[model samples]
Target chain A: MENDDTEYPVRYIPASKVLQAKVPFLDVSPNIALKKANNVLEEMAKDYVNWVQEDIKRLESTYQDLCEDPKSKDAITALYRVSYAMKGQGGTFGYDLVTFILNNLCRYLEEREEFNEGQLELIELHIESVRMVITHELTGKGGEMGKQVIMGLKQMINKKG
Target chain B: MSAKMLDLSNINILIIDENANMRIIVKQILRALDAHTTKEASGGAEAFTTLKTFNADIILTTWMMSPINGVEFTKMLRTSSDSPNPMVPVIMLSGHTEARYISEARDSGVTEFMAIPISPKSLYLRIAEVVLRPRQFVQTNDFFGPDRHRHDNEKYRGELRRQEDKEKQQDEMELTDAHNSLLKPD
Candidate 1:
């Protein structure tokens, strides 16, 4: 049995000492570990991108329904909750890119900010850009699409501010 | 009830996450668990300030943060006993599945490690585990109560909003060379 007296964040204990030792947080700076840990995070980000894409579709559909009837307080509350969940999980998963994009999306929802068509389009494009980034991170092929989307978002935010 | 879990109403829990939505989600989870009051921080520096001032009974912090990540922050906290602030129990949260992450967190004086997507049930269970078995989890601190905690969630939330807006504006305006560097090597 391993010693139970071991303190965390200092002594590393794992089944395979070799694989465990390479757990980058213990040895390397976060910048370097980002690369070492990228493989699993890339896979996780791919899965999460699919999840977020589905969520965005659902959110957009709900928003459209609410715009038609504007009285679905329960639906609105639930939408906020889902946005909050995405924000939490996105940050936790080491997908700060996803987190950044979702945070912007959530801010619009939280503030109940009425989005003009152009602003709504910008938000959608940002979400799509985040999705493209996740895809690129996963498959290393969608880099240009991701960059273009990010560039567009930059232009929009800059123009608005 | 089985073994009588720790009464959260009496315990001052500090939740630290760099994300505002995360702070809200974790607060909602605790609130669902009948926890009436939770001290929250958006980042490690803010968390430290809150801990020094409010003095929580237990701390729940996310592992990754800008400026000071959870592991480094906890290490700094464990050393704060010699400073003005005394020791406090810390629970570190992580999304990674690797056990070594937990080990590192533990070694750095983290009281417990709870995997992320921090739902009410998982957070309550983790808190119960730590509060129940202090010797195995964290060193007991007799100086924690709800009354001692400051009700500054609103203030912290406002400050966080300002910071987030500033960061977003900067990201938009500068499109700094550092942005691409943060993503991956070109």
Candidate 2:
């Protein structure tokens, strides 16, 4: 159980390195290419951060309501859609971490009919993992948030205690 | 699960393009066809990440984009083995009229293509064709998952028949062994 408050799970992939490895814009002017590339990187980070913010707000207001109700299928469906939305965009923009987290989120939500309290807790942990990545990446939080999220999820998912 | 137009209410479509006006126009077309859910991605990377996270039923992207072009994005997606709904039809919309470019798009796993300035009627019909086309090939794990969910009820029936054949063979072997013992006639 290494869920220390000091350690976060967010990992950073440098934008320059990502551009070199993943996308190389050819036939476009250098300034235009860099501008386009940077805009994409910035927008993806911004959009993801905003999406998590909305999710957090929704959870705060409706968490108990959804958890207690059996007919909250719409709420569950919305959550799955959010994760699936991330799945489509994350890998293309070089945010593999977000892509991976959302994918796990999708799998968890897909099995919602069979989800137990423990599995629900893991979903929360996965959300935390996403928040951790977004907070650090967006604010340049000097890496604290990432460690907290990473360690929290590791504690939840790691069974070899 | 009904094949009728009203039954697909749960489907969310992702439309990728750099043009805001184009996104809105396409959304309107989809909505006209009873598609209520739509998400927009403005660039290849954003579109890529969105596709990775979203459980969208269809993806309509333009070939010309800044940063990561549509061709490159499509190529990258085709390489991923863990992509959910790998068989999800991707229809590329391009303004390019060159035959060379069209074939290139086809070669890159683009299920269908349409010229830009696409009319509402054409868009609707193209979408219907893509969604309703008969499944002829093995949508194996060559895509992300088994083509079990997206396949029509008829395909599932065929799979069930294969399973039944295996079960019947097992039963016949047991019966044959019993008959052989009886024939020994001790």
Report the number of the highest-DockQ candidate: 1
How big is the positional error of residue A63 in model 1, measured in Å on the Cα after superposition? 25
Q: Can you give the DockQ of every candidate in the order shown?
A: 0.04, 0.01
* Model 2 DockQ class: incorrect
Candidate 2 structure quality by residue, lDDT tens digits, B21-61: 45655665566555678899988778767876787666788
Q: Which one is best on TM-score?
A: 1
User: Least accurate stretch of 10 residues (summed lDDT) in model 1 chain A?
Assistant: A19-28
lDDT tens digits by residue: candidate 2, A74-120? 66765664555444344444455666666666666665654456766
Error of 2 at A97 (Å): 46
- Residue A72 local lDDT, model 2: 77
Off by over 4 Å in 1: A1-161, B1-6, B81-86, B136-186
For this target, which candidate reaches the highest lDDT against the unseen true structure?
1
